[model samples]
Target chain A: MTALAIGIIIGCCALGAGIAMIAGIGPGIGEGYAVGKACEAIGRQPEAKGAVTSTMIMGCAIAETTGIYALVIAILLIFVAPGRFVDILTKAVRQIP
Target chain B: MQNSIQSRNPDRTTAKKPNKFVDFLLVLMMILPFAGCIALKVLFGNPGKGINVTGAQIYFTVKMPLQDMYITEGTAVSAAVVIALFALVLLLTRGLRRDPDTKRQLVAEFIVEKCDAFVEDNMGRGFLGFSPFVAAVMALSAFSSLSSLLGLYPPTSDISIVAGWAVVSFSLITFYKLRGGAWNYFRGFFEPIPLFAPMNVISELSTPVSMAFRHYGNVLSGYVVSTLVAAGLSSVSAALLRMLPGAIASFPLLRIGIPAVLSIYFDVFSGIMQAFIFAVLTILNVKNGFPEEEYERRMRKKQARRLEREGKKRPEREKNAA
Candidate 1:
């Protein structure tokens, strides 16, 4: 494989991981919105504090799953994908020769 | 008056200290996991010079027909420890009398009653029978996560452990829905219109996966952050202390005292909160799965049976029990 091809694969993997992490923005904003509403709810009915807090927590955790999924994908890109590209490219080169 | 009260209940005032041997055994149980971990680290572990943010360490692999089975260090050890802890609690609570003679019995009863009350409050009185199962899940999840504080590998840090529990809860949710009525349960997926069926199916399927990932991610992230912090601190300390004399320079001075503070949140707080969230989610999911009408019908039968026993106009509290 040419050096440029290897560099491009590595660069793309880096770019992909960085892009995948942008998925965190959605969860962050969503969770913040949920927490903001929950705060308003608890303020409106202080007696319902425990219920509101728990419900808010569950909602936030669910919201966080999207970011976690992104983290998993980014992890794969960094640790697994780059090596695969190189391995496949080298194998193809050997077969051609 | 306080003295009089104490005299009236001599057993409560003068309850014997737990047996010496039992106390020793309890301490031993707490210490054993940490000691075993340290010993293993000394003997067979190779934690290289970097932060270890990974899943359960594969302790061994067993041959299988189609594929090999990899056993992890975390799941096996934590499972044994948690089971043994449960057994020990059970053995201590054995042979209880009508009136509590020992504080141990009182404590055990307190736990059981509290578990029942939590279930009743959250999932309604119809779920009183589920209190034991709820308590078991809470205890298992909490213990597994808290084990990381002792330097033992946390079982819940591995996705498989949480995923297994999530799957169990998912099936229980399905079972409750089935009990409501098979036809209705299946047909409800098409609800309000047929075009929405695929969306409904996806939503239904997301429940378990979301639960598992939410929990596993939180706990694993906490573990990873704690590890990174410890490593970072060590490096920062080493850089600072390099100018010092030999032994002091080599030692990780910052690592000794700093990680414990972060650990309070990462290990203790996050562990407990995740366990609680998991339990609450399980209870809510199961409760919601059953049809509301079916629940009302079952509750009415229970109330009717209670009314027969009481032989009077049912009390206000009894009405709310529905």
Candidate 2:
């Protein structure tokens, strides 16, 4: 029974990690749009290629912050949160009257 | 060495042989560690049995008696930081050359000049005072992140270290803002409407948190992913080798090539990119806190006063402007 409970906790955490990774979609679309525009701008003025590329990279990196945050949360859930969570659950169950 | 060899091997076939030999040596160097590990596993019998998957292997922790506090990877990281700083100081102070004749002097001059130009371009000329601090932070961040390549846990992977850096940057930002005018700085928080003050305050507070997390998250994620990939590779190799005879069954032969490719991206590219971005953001934030035009105007006033003190006649245009 304890093994099943621990497995369920980890399974749920894995599900949460999968959910968290969905945030990557936003950055993917946003960066794609920005890169497309940047390419068009660079083509219009070849002399501005360096500036356009650097700006695009900077903008994309900033836009990637949300995705990175989600990744950090997912990592925490998968690697760090599970053990502490199981400990808490076990302690609470033991304290029941 | 290569030039001398090339000169001796003027024939096309001879030159091609040397090139091939060098390529072979490079490949051998790359694969040497994996080969050694496999050999050890075969001789020692299933070394992977001793591998610990959890906190035991990944983290190095020491307990402090005073508060029972756990000091983790910070111990290794702080030692690396101290060594790096000592080297930096030695490099800067040891050479007193009027003209850079040696390679070391040339490299030192290039670094100093580039750092100065980077600071001046971003923060303006009069604010070059901040260049040393910016250079130190950039060096620290870059070296700390790249330290992972040496198999040491990177300092930036710890959130607290990045937070400390962010706090220093935030304090500098606040100091510069206050220098502009304390009353204006306070009033600016409630600008355009009083209702927006709380939002303003929250945004101001979040600056340091975001900065800290941006770097810490990037480095830590890279470190975690690489470790996971390595473990996964080792397990896959172990399983595949199980099909062999008992002596070689436990050897993890396949754990060689893939992790090296991943490390190039995670350790090298991301580490350098994050360091550059951190420095860029620091310069931009500090530059924003103080107005360049105001600084330039003050400098002009000071120059005018100096000229007057010397009893030098101000130019006609300068007199009219003053």
Candidate 3:
């Protein structure tokens, strides 16, 4: 029974990690769109390449915030959640039986 | 490695080798750790427990004997902070000359000039006082994050340290906003409708949360990945050498070159980039917190000064219209 509970906890954490990483798509699309516009602007004004690149980098970093948050959540689920989950599960199981 | 090899070859051809004893001592110091580990393993029975590497393994935790308290990431961070402060003081205390004669003086001047320009660019010249704080944050973050490369746990990897920095920046933002005007700063939250106030408050709160998490997550992730890679490599090599007798099976030959290449990106590039982003975000948030009217007044004053410098008289008609 303990083994089954542990398996369930690990499986749920793996699923949560996968779901969390789905947030990566938003940043991927947003950053790609931003870079595309930046490229167009640079093409239009070659002399302003430095300004365009700096703005693009700043914008890209801000856009990456969501993706970074998702990554943090995923990392936590993978590395930290299982230990806490086991502790909680064991306590609950002891009370139930 | 190439530079060391070249220097060694030249020294061997020379009649007099300088600091040969010191060089031997350095090599011995480097080897002492592996030698000790081997000696401990030989003395004790092998439990056959493979290296149990995990995120927690990267951190060095020291527990106090009498209390439940423990010191972890603060150790590395405080050491980095002290070293940075000492270096800064040492650099500044060297006699100030019109012309910087030594390399250290030149580097110090370069850093000061660059930090001044960065602060001015982001927060405007009126907020030049913030340059020192910004410079310190950037220096501390970069140095602490990069310290992980030296096998010390980086302080930025600790969420609490990053959160402390973020909260300090948030407090500065709030202080500036209150200085601008308390009534309007509070009223700004309820703008458009009362329903949006909670949303505004949440957005305001998330600024620090996001800032803290971003730095912590990046550093910690890099540390975890590199550690896992090292552990994986060692385990793979160990498994391959299992056929060999006893001690030879445990040798980790594959753990050298590959991780160094990964560290260049994870440790060096990410460390510098995260430090820069943290400073830039701090400047942006602080500058954004100032009242719009004050900002406009400063802009107008600057424009008037610029026009005056060009030998143009202020138009009486425009002043009357204002």
Candidate 4:
């Protein structure tokens, strides 16, 4: 059962990492949308392409932020959560008490 | 009209199929290097796992064209060389484009536009004064994040990187204060409260530190997590093979696909987001300058609108003249 629990934790972590990439889908769609808008604006007003492209890039950058947050969470789950480490620490503290 | 664009092509004398071979080669080029490394890790052993460099275990590794080098400390040749090369390349590239030629101006314009929008959204119209800082922050973050996607450690995840930006940001604030009016700026620090000045000052002084830590915490956490997962999975696969050879031989197929997806998120998605957040936070911090002044200016415009509405009869005179 202890082994099962460990397996489950690892499996969940693997799933979390994959799910985190799904967050990137938003930015992917958003960046594509931004580019499409920039292209359309450039076609309509060629002179404004500079302004349009810049705005698009900025918006895309912001939209990309959410995906980053997801990535960070995914990474934390895998590497630095201090999960088992913390558990060990707590057990040590409890033993002392 | 958009759907008919291909049909309306003037040079449609012969319909041509896209060269699938070239397209496949491009895809292969992007994947082959990383795929080869992973394959080698599974087949033999990835020497990168907790590499012992000069008697110390280091968390970082670098891949050259043929060999992989692990660096356990800041002094290690592998990490130091790569970082130095990256910095030198960056500096040389910047130096090459230092002159205000036609191409530079176009790049500058794009940078200006991004800066303007960032400031306007976060700090409103008063963003013009700190435009240079905004441009610098955005450019740095973008380059760092883009490099992370290309399979290099994002410098943004480094504590020193955050500290460097924080120092620059704090310096800009001081400079802006001096330029805007030294007396008001210095006194403004104590204007809202006099008795708790020391605590306020300390808090204000620590703002940059806090900013740096916030960014470092988020990015460092992600970097550590991804590395652990990758290592942990590799070990688990190895152990399972030793324990029950038959049942877990099929496990490799299950493991690779799942973790590859995770790597894309950890390495690409999170890296880019953290970079943007760091830049945005910097821009937001610099933007506090214009709020008080811009609010007053906007208030005056509102008052003028009210007066114009009260004097609504003036439009009739203009209409009669026309």
Candidate 5:
């Protein structure tokens, strides 16, 4: 029964982690749009390429934080949070016997 | 050696062929780490049987009134390696001439010149003095992250290490903002409307938090993903190889060269890219903290008022000289 319980908990966590990764879509789109605009601007004024590239990189780095946040959440769900729940589940099962 | 700075790269023949010296150093670099690994294995028996996914291993703890500080393996080992590398680089570039005869001097000059120009172009001419601090931070971050390539836990993957640097950056931002004026610094919180002060304050605090988390998350996720992939590959290779004949079945050949390609992107590219981005963000944030032109104008106006008070008799520099 405990083995069955642990499997279900981990499966749920996998689902949550998958859902959390949807945050990547937002930043991926935003960054692509920003870069597209930056490319257009650079094309119009090639001399400003250095400034444009630097600014775009800085902006993208900031935008990337949200996607990174999602990744962190997913990592936590997969690696860290499951262990605690498993421990608790095991302890509860042992006490009931 | 006799050439002036104007005679740039003067007489390439002055560079004595350090071919043997380069070979010797390269050999030392390889052998030292390999020997250390052997010594570590002898001391600790074998490595843990399976993958261990945790932050830097806490070696010991120091108690304080407020909080206990735990010094981890990453802090001790990686820090020592970083300092040794810094010393080695410093020693190499020690006798560098202004005219740049040796390859060592050229490397040193190239780094300094690039950093100076990068800072100057990004943050304007007035912030040129900040190049050293920015470069140092970048070097520390890049090196710390790259330490993972040595099969050690990277310090950058730990939030505490990255947060410490982020806090320093935040403090520098605050210090620069105060340079404008105490009034302007305090007044900024109430910009647009006084009701927005709380939001501004929260945003101000979140800057460091966000920066710290961004770096920490990026490095940690990469490290974690790579660890998972390696462990997965070992098991899969074992399962696959089991069908083969006796001796060959035992070897996990798939684990050999495959991970190196993945590491090129995760360890090398991401490490350097994140360091560059962090340095750029730090510079830009600090530069934007104060109104540079307004501060200069205010200082000039104050100086003019002082001159008027002194009846313009002695002049500014003469009075200081006197």
Candidate 6:
């Protein structure tokens, strides 16, 4: 029973970590695309360099929002960890049943 | 090198992209710890299990044998060693002599020149005074962000660091206003609103706390989650994969692949974004000091100007004069 509880707790943490990282996919693709477009715009009108650069920066910043969300989740798991509680709970339940 | 700069055009392909090696190195710094964490998980057990709590397996250990000090996981000593090493490297790099004629040096020169151009084009030469502040804060945040991702103790994740940065920014604005005029700085705060002065003051005091907490909270969260995930998954896989024969033992990717994906999100994506957000917020706070006052002033001035153009004054102004 203790073994089963431990396994489940471990599995949840693994799954949670994976879920947190999934947030990165959006920004990775978005930032790359933004850089490409910004470069293209700069190529078209060098005179609009200021506008292009600022817009690009602003867009990239916005793209980072998801990453921040993921980071928050990751931090929560490490610092205020509750996985052990699950392990303990399951173990007690198993003992009773 | 000079020729490269001279011929360099933003529109032209002749302009070289920034060194990919540097980018790779920066990214590597963030992942190194995760790699270590995984290795430790397989060799030992999960270190983060009792990381911060009492009565838990002390994640860190130190032993002195034969007049030599040895340290183990979860010690501040580990962080100190890394910081000391980084500082040493920085010092060495600082002492290196660069040939102005070399391509690499030219690249550095080009970046500085581009930065100057950007500042001048947007905020003018007067803003150069603030350029160092901007560059320093951004660079530090970037480095800190990367370090966080790598599973290194990010100094920026500490409240002390965040508060320190906020204080620096706040002091700079205060000094600028002092030089500009006491009334100007005092007036600057009240420019946007005179009625809600108390609320403004409270927020002004709270900015440092919020700034620090925001950065620490975000980065710390990422570190914790990644650590848990790594610990849990590796233990499961270690047990499961052990049951398999030698053929399957060779390829642990079945277990590791999933954790790697999580690391990517927490380390790569969250790390960089949080750093950028911290830097951006720092810049914004500095730039938009007393925005409410500024807004109110503009509104009042516009009203007065409109009344003047119409050959009639606002009732408030008329009443004041009367």
lDDT of 4 by residue, B109-159 (tens): 565567676667777665555665565565555455444444345555665
Candidate 3 or 6, higher DockQ? Answer: 3
Q: Which candidate number has the best DockQ?
A: 5
- On residues B119-173, what C-alpha lDDT tens digit does candidate 5 reach at each position? 9988988898899898888888988788778776778888888899999999999
Where does candidate 3 chain B have its weakest 10-residue lDDT segment? B52-61
Interface RMSD of each: 2.2, 2.3, 1.9, 7.1, 1.3, 5.0
Q: Among all windows of ten consecutive residues in candidate 2 chain A, which has the lowest summed lDDT?
A: A57-66
- Which pairs of residues collide in candidate 4? A79-B225, B58-B72
A1-30 per-residue lDDT for model 1 (tens digits): 378898999999999999999999999999
Q: What does candidate 3's lDDT look like per residue over B71-163, in tens digits? A: 444443445455655545454435434433556557777787899888888888899889879988898889878766665567788887889
Model 3, runs deviating above 4 Å: B1-69, B292-322
TM-score of each: 0.80, 0.78, 0.77, 0.45, 0.81, 0.50
Top TM-score prediction, candidate number: 5
Candidate 6: Cα lDDT at A92: 77
Native-referenced DockQ of model 3: 0.53
Stretches off by above 4 angstroms in model 1 are A1-10, A38-51, A79-94, B1-38, B245-248, B292-322
Q: Give residue B301's error in model 5 in angstroms.
A: 5.3
Put down candidate 2 lDDT per residue, B1-322, tens digits, no spaces. Answer: 2244345445443222124454455455434533443343355343545543333122333567775545445444545565656555554434334433446556666777798898998877878878878888888888788777766567788877889889998998888777655676888889989999999999999888888888888888888888788878878888888879887876767767788788888888888878878888887888787755565666678899999999998788978986
* Model 4 chain B lowest lDDT segment of ten: B91-100
Clashing pairs in 2: none
Task: Report how far off residue B299 is in candidate 5 (Å).
Answer: 2.3
Question: lDDT tens string, model 6, B141-206?
Answer: 656555544444555555555577778766765554355445666765565779777777887777
lDDT of 2 at B214: 83
lDDT of 1 by residue, B138-232 (tens): 88888888878778678887788889999999998899888766788989899989999999999999999988887777777677677888889
Better candidate number, 5 or 6, judged by TM-score:
5
